[model samples]
Target: MAEKIIKGIVIDRFNFRDFDLIVSLATNFGVIKMVARGVRRPTSKNIYILNPGCLGEFEIFLARYSNKLSKLKKGECFFNLDLNDKKIYAFWKLVSQITRETNFVPKIFPILEQSFAKINSKNADAIKVYTIINWIKFNGWIANLTRCRVCKTNQRLINFNFYGGMECVYHQNPKPFFRFGRKELEIFYWSSSNLNTFLEKVDFDYIYLVFEILKQFLKQNSYIFL
Candidate 1:
């Protein structure tokens, strides 16, 4: 097969015997793993561009099968997020780990770029919550929170059913559900529509609530969490 030039974000890396390493990157094609021979050596030129969370153009010798690792011929960095910021660094790492390996997710790149930009702007909490919600939304796990899934009523939704989706007080059933207070529902609705605005004014409690809900949902459905 012909060599392909692709741009991607280096999300994770694993050291191999001696001076080699395996690097995983997120590209338009999906998550790709490539072998970087001798990159662990002190004098290796590829080390700089292979840093985790670095976005760059790369020359990849594509593998015949998606599960097999490809050969990385060369790479040039566009940008590398400062890994010194422990919070943001950890957040991106988790995002990379939770994302599916071989599947295509069209919205992943924009959401990741926006997330990095938001962290660079120092809006850490807001952007973290916003990014997670968008991830869930793009993955098709988010149900319409504004109306009841069954009755299609505009009444307040207070119960969350993994099997049946969001529900109202009058539509309760035997399925297990997560109950939310009125205040939490209001915040959920507001945040979904006006995430940027909510970020500007969100308090710690609001951020905590949003994360709790999202974490549980993700863990239940995708078996991944922050």
Candidate 2:
């Protein structure tokens, strides 16, 4: 079998057997699952490289079978992101949401890589994270968060249709849906603006609210939350 080295993020992991693991990784090529032999052993060198959120450089042996399961031959940590407890939880929440919303591995590996780098950065704010997510959605790749689909206005006082898109106050009715106040809209706009400005001045509270809104939105769409 030909050996290959690849850079990837540990999106998920599960025990395969006594001392072995099956890990789901989002790599530059695509999402792939690999078996790591003896990874659970106390003295295993690969144990440190198998953690979720860790960026790794891995040596893998591709199998001949059509199922595409690879064997992890070796791995090394590229960067062990130093996230505090609160940040760690936030990171996990974002990852969970992303994995659920997306079916296939994204073609934009740079975006995913940048997200990981931002989440790991010491200077990253909660609002920055929120904005990044919104940016992705607005780009038409994830979800819609732009003008009201009905009213066609960019006003902040908006209602989110359960199906998708936003609605302005003019189109608002007694329909069962989620609404965003002016403040939330301001936060959303600020977060989704250019990356540099967002990173410079984003609030934790504002970002937290956006996160909750996104969670609810995803829930309404029947996405799994972890």
Report backbone clashes per prediction. 0, 1
- Model 2, residue 21: what's the lDDT? 94
What does candidate 1's lDDT look like per residue over 1-226, in tens digits? 4599998888889998899989988877788888988989988888989988788899999999877889899989987777778766667656676555733375767666656545653566556666766566666755655567689786767765544356788886555546666655555555455445655644546666767777777677775657
- Local distance difference test, per candidate? 0.71, 0.63
Q: Per-candidate RMSD vs. true structure?
A: 4.0, 4.6
TM-score of each: 0.71, 0.67
Residue 94, model 1: lDDT of 62
Off by over 4 Å in 2: 17-19, 38-43, 64-66, 81-84, 100-112, 120-176, 190-197
Candidate 2 TM-score versus the reference: 0.67
Model 1 per-residue lDDT at 102: 39
